[model samples]
Target: MTFAGFLGLALQTIKAPRDVARLLLSARLSSEALWTAFALVVVLNTLVFSATIALMPQDGFGLLGNPVAFMVVQAAALAGAVIAIASIGRAMGGKADLAQVAVLLIWLQSLRVLAQAALMIIGIASQPLAAGLALGVSVLGIWLSMNFIDEAHELGSLFKSAGVLILALMALAVGLSLLLSLLGVVPQGMNGYV
Candidate 1:
């Protein structure tokens, strides 16, 4: 797609996400194409992340500071989210399949990378403005996700999409907690909190 097409779709995602979701679903991207796009977005996100860390070095990224490890975690987290959306939506009687969810999520992630890049550049000029824009993008991301999920699953309402999102997030949190516990990554006395 040309830059104009990309910008148009991105704007549409913010303006009319359900329509964009429908358009994406209708594209019927092949599984291979979807996976390739997913990987590309994940890598792009990792690159953006590395840039962020370089620009504002933090105290404790630890394992995540390693680019390859960060990419692996990023891919896993994204894949898990796609699976959760598909599985939970189906369990809740919605109709979207894994590939359908994956495509929308991959597109969203691609947009997120672009937003992060823009925010990084803006941060170089004005930190407070960049921070405010980041907050706005986050809220926009949540709104977009609700619309995308509703359209993908034919959920028929933003309320249902919100329900699905909540459930998926809860599941992911519990699953992550369990995984960290299993790996003994949770610090002593902090297990309950996690």
Candidate 2:
């Protein structure tokens, strides 16, 4: 897609996320294709994240300091999120399959990469503005995810999708925290996330 087209879609994703979710779901992507795109999006996101971290002053964030490790963690986290959303949504009577969930998430992640790049550029001009943009983007990400889940699962209710998202995030946090602890990969200067 052209840059303008991408921007238009990005705007649509924020303005009418349910419709964007429907458009993505209607693509009828195969599981393999969805997974491959998911992987690619994860990698792209990692690259942007790593680059952003590299350019910033050395913070105490050791986990994000290692690109390879960060990439691995990112991939695992995203895959877990996909599974959690798909399963939890299904248990909640959502009709979306794993592939449908994957597509929406992958598209969201792709947009995240774009947002990250924009933040990086904006950070160069004004740190405060960049911080504000990051906060706004984070909020929008949550909102978009809720809408996407609702659309993908045909839940027809943002409240149900919000519940699924909350449960999925809680599960992910617990699971990742445990796995990270087991692997002795605690972030520097921070207690274990429980």
List all candidate RMSDs to the true structure.
2.5, 2.3
lDDT of each: 0.88, 0.88
lDDT of 2 at 95: 93
For model 2 the local lDDT of residue 28 reads: 97
Off-target runs (Cα >4 Å) in candidate 2 are: 190-194
Q: Which stretches in model 1 have alpha-carbon errors above 4 Å? A: 178-194
Residues 1-194 of candidate 2 have per-residue lDDT tens digits of 79899899999888888889989999998878887988888788888887887677657756656777777778878888999999999999999988888888988988999999999989978989999999999999999999999998889899999999999999999988886677677777566455
Predicted structure 1, TM vs. truth: 0.91
